[model samples]
Target: MNNQTISAQLLSPFNMGDLPLKNRVVVAPVTRSTVGEKRLRFMAKYYAQRASAGLIITEAAVISHQAIGWLNSPGIYTEEQAEDWKQVVNAVHSHKTPIFLQLWHCGRASHSSFQQNGQLPVAPSAIKVNGDYIHTPLGKQAYETPKALETEEIAAIVQDFSQAAQLAKIAGFDGVEIHGANGYLIDEFLQSKTNHRTDKYGGSIENRYRFLGEIITAMTKVLSPNRIGVRLSPNGSYNDMGSSDFRETFLYVAQQLNQYGLAYLHVMDGLAFSFHELGNPITLAEFRQVFTGPIMGNCGYTQETAEAAIEKGDADLISFGRLFISNPDLVERFANGWPLNPLVDRKLWYRLGEEGYIDFPAYASSS
Candidate 1:
């Protein structure tokens, strides 16, 4: 494929609903594990550095104290936290780049150490994550069996997502993406392996989807459906996710979400993150068939692969996580064929410092 042709496809301008993008490339949300009072300033710089991307999804911000698990990660539950994030939004908007806040709830992925008053983490079921360890504020600790949320308690958590969406708007975010992927709180409710409840929120696929469905309904009350997005990781094994009915579950999810007319459906279709290997992985084409809205494909997409996905009509936008981290000027590199910086070491990915976070120079500076 011609480099210029490749550039035109991936780095080209596109419209996701009413939102116009400068390019089709997206800065996927990444957990830096480096947020604190002092780190908020760094967070602003970190996101502002890559404002050239078509859209930027800020790292998953915990929706409530019950939603926190990652150490030092930002939270949007309080007015003060939302005010802090407003600065980051201003920094990105300074470049005329549209950014979205990803509302997250860690669910059973968290430990009591991260919870208030040392209460057990909550989930749809009482099962514990199969993972060996979770990084808590105390230290690296074993995964704890979570408290199963009662049917009566589900409404409050759903309202938390709604309140978080409203807070995101107040923070001046152009939009909000619900973090429903990668074995997090929402994902735990979606997958059968994790959700073992017999209430209205569990049992069959429709019942299982009720938790996320209610979240969307609640969020739409504060934010327009067009200003919202949802992420799904049907093929991932992260946090011990993936079920026997994975294909049926996600396709049904897409079909239902289609009725909502969301801004986009972000699907992690690439196997770069280990796949569950239960059966054949679900593809973007599968989602495209059901979801009528714009589709964003993520996970391990190179310029060539991203270009192909868009050119083939499989994805309207392609998000880059590691690439965006290393090459802040990823769109320019694809447009001009500049050499990309080497991938940073995994250990340094979540470290709290400027060494490997925002120190990488763009091609203009490097050359």
Candidate 2:
């Protein structure tokens, strides 16, 4: 496709702080089982195929032994794991793609088997969000009522995140994105419904946001604030999450994050799965009003819709999830106005091997 056929907004060069890109399209993180060395090899190939992205955010990797919940997700806490990740960085960098490792902790969304010595999952409170199930080695199990982290223990978790950020740097990531969304550890603290702590960590909005702010501060010691970005889902029900005062809480959080001069704010809303039904619904535009840095709008954005959102000034960039999974050449397809491949095999998302993982054909082969 010629440059004339591509939409100007998407193909136009853009700058997101230290990240200069050929376009504003990003490949959002997607979970793949990290069971062994072979998987990391697969992961390297998985990311390299989509290196055309302006920025690639890797799947959420657990920060520490205490932070695991996803049964098969990858990690970066150990020296060996970091060494393995170096291969991934080399693969993506070969194509000159800028990538970020997303540091995460599952919090209460975990079962005993995933934790060391069968220890209970940890969170801000002993509350359990029912209806959500976690996959364990034994099999899928219901969510556990997590052990409440003592004030001292809370600090340890922060340090774990700090350590992980440094490890990510050592692994050769361009930067890191804190996974502060999707009802995980950081999100558990931010939401009033989940955080019942009476101490400084949980009463009001500021208290709830304290945990997230401290994490950002810690990461900045090793990486530039301009190179750091955060993902938040103020209106998501993915992990059975919600609060009575989501608007006030999230707006306060957004306003505060602006002070750090972050690279971008990636938000997920307006999709059937990410509904904000319980509270006053907030949009990306409202966040734009509060945060000066760029905002990336996620959750099922088509090429036409993404371009329109950018033109309307609602978002500086648009991230693709499922589309990127099935179309390795998603940007090229969109740029050339080629029809998207609607054949997504969801059944193989968690299955082992490369059939549905790295086997998706590029545009040339598919056409």
The alpha-carbon lDDT assigned to residue 271 of candidate 2 equals 70
lDDT by residue for model 2 over 83-119, one digit each (tens)?
8899889999999889999999999988788788999
lDDT (Cα, tens digit) per residue for candidate 1, span 189-250: 99999988888888999999999999999998998899999999999999989899999999
TM-score of 2: 0.96
TM-score of each prediction:
0.98, 0.96
Using TM-score, give the best candidate's number.
1
Candidate 2's C-alpha runs over 4 A off are 1-6, 37-41
Give residue 179's lDDT in candidate 1 (0 to 100): 97
Clashing pairs in 2: none
lDDT of 2: 0.85
